[model samples]
Target: MKRRKFIKKSLIGGAAITMPFVLPSGRLFASSGNRMADHVVFVAFAGGVRQQESVLQRYLDDSQAYPSAGNIMYNILDGAPPTDKIVYGTTNYVNGDTPIPKMLSQTLQQQGTFFKEVNASVVGHYAGVNTLLTGNYMFTQGLRNKPLTPTIFEYLRRLTGEKATKTWFIGNGIGNSIPLLDYSTHSDYGAQYGANFLAPIVTFGNSGDKHLKNAKVYHPEEELDPMYKMKYFLDNVWYSQGSALPNIGNTEEEKLEIKQFVRDMFQKKDNGSIAFPPISDSGDLQTIGYACEVLKRFKPTLTVIYLSNVDGCHGNFSSYLRSLHRADHGVGHLWDFIQNQVPEMSGNTTMIVAPEHGRNDDPNGIKDANAFYGYDHSDSNSQRIFNMMVGPGIDSNLSIGNENNKVGDIVNIAPTIAEILGFKNDIVNTGLLASNQSFFDLI
Candidate 1:
């Protein structure tokens, strides 16, 4: 109930915003993917995040200081605590004001291999989520009439050798449905659709889905018992929507193939298995829990996890201590698990954590009449996001690069992953494809 109101009030007028941050032009990487980043593990705030709450920020006006992110040691597993505040940069937090800053230059500098300038033109949750997940984006009004493009999961399958069969979109606030890039019905899946462009097997959930713990204990060879059925009816609902549409394409064979694919997906809905909850837009606790589960049990070679609690707490601008603490803790756990629990995950994995976008915060919402608008990220493309990188092949402490004010826009992520996976796709999506070579040093 509160969330619906939140969305309604936060909705911006007109079309959704689209900002593309492309990589700097030049040959920076001598090579790609260091020893530690042999594999890829991506963690993101499913929803948009203001820089104030995360690792980096772009500053224009006065910013506030909350808590400093403990240096790497402070976050070390069971390491000695720092006696003083682990201040990386200065903050000037005031009561009732948005806790975020208009600019976070210091945070940007300290943020190892992070992007300083990134933007999310849209303010709505769905638009931001779509933009972040898929390189393609739609502005506020355009989104209502149009559809988004394929996401990382889809790209991973089509371009890279990686299969969507093992992929997961855990705890999706919105039920999993592949976004459609083809604008018109003719270009889109059309009326007779098989499997309807794309679909993931099972969505991992949180407390509601307790199957994770049990799955961990059970051997992989063991057959999932009687209760583990994935109701084909649910998947068919999606297929039915596709099938019921009029034949979209000019050709008959294509139409038949489309319908056939959708039917096959329905029949095989129960085939794959995962145990995390569908993530909630409200916060990040469940996301942390899910990441821990993946690290402990199902360590898919290519994975993407969403963390948004920081965004939530910051948006409210009350006491975000809990949100920051949780984000820091969650990040620590993931890193620790990679090194300790899943030793193989260390050098073999490349971890990328980036926020959807930045915000305009200073901790005191009541300070002005503009409190409501103060809670969100600005439209300025020069400064509105942050990115973090770490892994076997990466340098311990580093910044993104020094070519452009921005490293790349939201569109570059898929290609970055594809590069790490050693896959090459000549055709690309919106904006220029950001090269993955920048990841070499951070590995």
Candidate 2:
């Protein structure tokens, strides 16, 4: 079948055959409280960022014992760019010498509130993200298992009755148990209230080009009938065995929209029309590009984009610095696209950025090409990170906390998102959160 025709017909009959089923519970009632913003974009500016390099504006001084001290993350923080040992930018004959031009006219710190030093109780990747999404430390949460408590996606969907497509979790790739974060194992809120998840790089990269791009559009009466029977049989078997199949709950209409959006992305990628950042070299930058597409296409009430390129710090500090700089560039592009391209989310959206955790203060004996030592997480220094938010009604050019005084916890992010979307009462009243206070309360 022709690709366009396949998309149209697949929308009509593909739900039954699609794996990881979509079994939407009927929508509840709308939220009652007033919303601070029509939409919220939470960037898990993740991958174990170090406070010295990011928020402290110390480029090499703190990490390498160099006299140089300036910010490489110029788009998010208000500080001058590094003047020496410029190894964190795009290549200009010499490695990483040409910094990507800033995308936002003003830094996010200037446009919103900045939490200089936030506490991240969990230092590991999965646990830190679990804390950020569930608002509970869940120190016992297993690496490969779903979250023990309900995630913010669950609270928002269950309380506000938002559609599956209205909440999204866009991961850079499906590794590190990224695909499992859409929902949780909570009895009260599991797959039925999960967010739609997409690891765009995998979905649109080489594997997808071979498997999903030209998926056959099976005839409904002839081919779909047998597929449906098999699906039902498998689903019944799974259920009878006391196991529930994962369901993202995308309604038929939403599914159609999602498929169409995927098709459009492939075409856009081919034509070089994706809204990629000016320096779309790293995985994080590519992920941010697809994230921009998601926002433009879905206009979701809550969208979480996870970028982990900076995790390279474990082995290559130079690459980590480059990733960190590119991350800031990508974030600037994302915010700029939201404000200028996506009309629906332009003025009414709130953007929040926070790393899941921080890297250690001391080096781990691994040195990069620049003779700089690598850093690992697992100490008091790893608990230190920063959070920032920019949107309507949020104070501009405001900063809270300091080196000696930490202000917010990683767990506060979930409740902060709930508060912004007018579902804080619903989320907090359940008593499942580690702390009910949002960043506003901390302020």
Candidate 3:
């Protein structure tokens, strides 16, 4: 009854604020197999990527005025740039806005295992990403709704007995069902095993900047003003109407730690102590910076970073090219930070990246400033996406699939991540996984 009251009173404007952090009893599906890596970073790469442009390294050949192609995504793969009609928004264009050079020498393809073609069964963004996290094709899952099955976060936390601090989903933004993917609605593994979700830009920008910045602790009865202010703030801003969003299952101690981290981040942002790639305005890059901060502070076992700037392909092709290149730049910086700054996670962590789905076969007739046609996603082009993994135990300079064949499914990524983090058997035995196969087994 006390728990019910706590939830009931916290419900303001139809949204339930996060209850005080606590852990439920017992592990659900404890793992018996040996863990492969100490940590896992799953880059959702949300917003479908196209094959001809991304893995195949074709820049503008498919949907632009130029018939030439080049490797704009230099960090993810090893390929050459387009020699003629180079109008994919490069500073190399001589009249471009920002002169950003492509980092080509030591690409992820050179250092990691790259899958040229991974099948993303679902074409829609919400369903595709849900498929990536749940290892099942969720045809029933819809926009702005929580997943219908257990996410990888729930699997890792429940099976490994890891605390909320050790599992995180750092999203780029809160749109569609992005925020809901942190946890699922499954009866067996639900809110109690969900990951710590921090939409840094969203939280820090609006309410946090005003309420949390340099704020002191307050007693409930002694300082009711601040409490009510916070209540109103959370209810009005953080959550939507009539939505009882699940909270990240952290212990009280972990909650305090996260609070401290947030305070420190605010201070760092003000003092310019936050380390980011110099002079970049992309939201994904900013999110990556905060994700790095979380890794440095908490050293989580699994961290999923979602990047969706590439979704600009829906309208502006030139901006899409720019965003895609900048996304690679952000990813490269993140890997570098892990290697140099976060010493504990430096050598032991495994990083796996794949898009939620791929773009359509042809343009949607939306042209950019450069006369380049923008593309969309559907069942037609969603069949082929790419996957890349780099870390200890993963094969280096290995490329799976080719022009003649497709290799993996987007659903396979979750099981593969589970296998990497020592919970493959547990996840597979749950009967939740579809027809996806782990990379470990494939290799």
Specify the highest-lDDT model's number: 2
Rank list by lDDT: 2, 3, 1
Residue range 43-145, candidate 3, lDDT tens digits: 8877778888888777776666467788877777787766765544436435344435654358888889988877787888878888888989998777787
Writing each residue's lDDT as its tens digit, candidate 1 over 334-410 gives 66556656765765776676656555544334322223222554445313655566555345556553324555666
- lDDT for model 2, on a 0 to 1 scale? 0.91
TM-score comparison, 1 vs 2, better candidate: 2
Model 1's alpha-carbon lDDT is: 0.42
* Candidate 1 TM-score, true structure as reference: 0.54
lDDT tens digits, residue span 315-366, model 2: 9999999999999999999999999999999999999999999999899999
lDDT of 2 at 79: 88
Identify the runs in model 1 with alpha carbons over 4 angstroms from their true place.
1-38, 52-112, 119-123, 140-147, 172-283, 313-315, 361-374, 381-383, 401-404, 426-443
Q: Quote the lDDT for 290 in model 3.
A: 87
Model 3 misplaced regions, further than 4 Å: 1-25, 28-30, 83-99, 102-105, 218-247
lDDT of each: 0.42, 0.91, 0.80
Which numbered prediction scores highest in TM-score against the true structure? 2
